[model samples]
Target: MAEHANIPAGKGRSNAAILVACVAFVAGMVGMSFAAVPLYRMFCQVTGYNGTTQRVEQVSSVILDRTMRVTFDANVAPGLMWNFKPVEREVMPKIGETVKVHFTATNHSSEPKKGQAVFNVTPMEAAAYFNKIECFCFTDIELKPGETLDMPVVFFIDPEIVNTVETKDIGTITLSYTFYPQEETKPVAVLPAGKADGNQKL
Candidate 1:
């Protein structure tokens, strides 16, 4: 009877170990899935896949005489209570010439709101050559109620764009930005005495 009992106890310990191993494997997979999102976005940005634009630190040194028409588009996602639009509809910029464009955003909600902008370039092939030096899309924006802000984006088209067979003939490139609400909230800004709204004194 004692020998039989020992065999069953050993089997139970082995079964428990197997269960733990399986649980660990599942947790690791879940972690990888979460990590994959940002990794995939980085990959697209680097390769210019899916119209994702590239980020650069400095302005282009070479400016081509040939100019290209670039258009702007702005959108607000469903959850964010903000009004967003490009200050300018379009501009003609010479290749490799740095240009700055502005977009305005106003928070219509009563409370402070945070949002992040995602951007992309149209004519898919042009994304690889459309580089951004400074962009508001890089970080989250926090705005107090009725606060309006002008956001700027500085970028230049790569001179190499004219050399590429796929992009050389492209006439116009459209840059679009969409704002979405952030999951985390930021601290609200305190208003001064007698100041009820962003404008107008009590």
Candidate 2:
């Protein structure tokens, strides 16, 4: 009789543990689903992967000896009222050669406004082969209404770019940019195969 009573108690304890485990499993799955968007954005930023805005601060881990992609991002303020673009559409420079690209920011706003530009390069396959000489993405950019100014990005193709046979096929490379609002921006711009018009990269 004692053994029968103990068996029932043990079974009840086992059932309670199973119920707790099931609840935990469901909660974990729900949490993962909620976190999916941010996680995906992070992946794109690191890989230039899904075209979504990236979250990586910098690309310092790439292997310089091999080939990689050189990616760039640009943003402008909405209140500033400006027309901006990278001067040069494409380039194919020798390793270690410095290249300059311009972003022409023209304020059409009726009133003078102040804003800053945020820019960065994603030297995807060429992270090691890439270096920035001058860039305006840092610090806040101040502009007056109806003012037109050119922002510059002075950079160089690392000699290591030529060392890798894969990058050799890259006779033509693209330096790209996009304008964003002053506050923190969301990855929402879906730029098509657009041209910079007359802007030239130096």
Candidate 3:
């Protein structure tokens, strides 16, 4: 009887150990799931994957003679009652030449609205070479009823873009932005106080 009892006790301890290990594994997975989004965003920012462009304060001094056409595009996500578009349809700039462009957003609804923009560039290969010094993306944009604002983006194409075999033949790159309504219940703070256009980076 004693021997039999010992066997059952040992089996119960083994089962409990297995249960604890499984729970720890599951918790670890859940933690990673929460971290996945920001991690992927950092990866995209670094590698320019999925048309993501690099952010920098300044670019190289070497300006290439080669010119490239840059097209602007804007869109609004569903449920966001706003009119958003690029002020300029297209611009021709030499490689490494910094250019500034504007996008206008108007809130057509009666109440205040908050939005954030997701941006990308194409042909996708050029994304790696497209650098932005300041942009309205990655920040909350709030607009009062009937408010219109001009958003600015300052950027340059890396002069070394010509050296990349993948983007050598690309003559045009399109920078696109899409605004989606923020789902948070509380209103997010708007851009810092500055010019009427609020072109300053926060």
Candidate 4:
């Protein structure tokens, strides 16, 4: 009876150890959940895994004969009372040539508004080949009541895009941005002003 009692005690200790391991694993996974978003964002930026493009300091000098149509898109999140649109419908630029475009944003609210833009490119694989030299999306934007500003983005299509089999056939890419009011700012809503309803898709 003593020996049998020792066997059960040993089994109890083994079960306790397994339970501790499982708890530790669950805790570790929960901790990772908090860090997942930013980590995944960094990974995508580095690898262009999803339509996230590259940011380069200097423009590429090597130009290619291939041309691509770059389109712009904009949207204001429900909580944000602002009008935003691309200045142009589309641009055709040869590979490796830099181009500049503007997006105008206006606050239609009676109170000051603060917002930030989140952007991505379409045709996910082509993201790795789109390089941005300068972009207003890098920082937060604030607008006084009824104030308007033209945001600019300077970019170039990488000439190397032609070398990659995955992106070689992609002759068009759309750069889209969506603006959301900062939660901390607590922006008030107001009726939209002129041309605010124009959400052009081209």
The alpha-carbon lDDT assigned to residue 24 of candidate 2 equals 100
User: Which predicted model would earn the best lDDT?
Assistant: 1
Q: Taking the tens digit of each residue's C-alpha lDDT, what string does model 4 give over 1-202? A: 4553346878899999999999999999999999999999888878777889888899898998878999999999998899999999799999999999999999999998889998899999999888998888888899999999999999999888888899888889999999988756455875456435776345
lDDT of 3 by residue, 93-171 (tens): 8999999999999999999999999999998889989999989995899999999999999999998788889988899
Error of 3 at 148 (Å): 0.3
TM-score of 2: 0.47
Q: Rank the candidates by lDDT, best first.
A: 1, 3, 4, 2
Q: What is the lDDT of residue 148 in candidate 4?
A: 98
Q: In model 4, how many backbone clashes occur?
A: 0
**TM-score of predicted model 4?**
0.79
Clashes of each: 0, 24, 0, 0
Candidate 3 or 1, higher lDDT: 1
Compose the digit string of candidate 2's lDDT tens values, residues 74-134: 4554554777765655554444555566777777777655566543343345443445556
Candidate ordering by TM-score (highest first): 3, 1, 4, 2
Q: TM-score of predicted model 1? A: 0.82
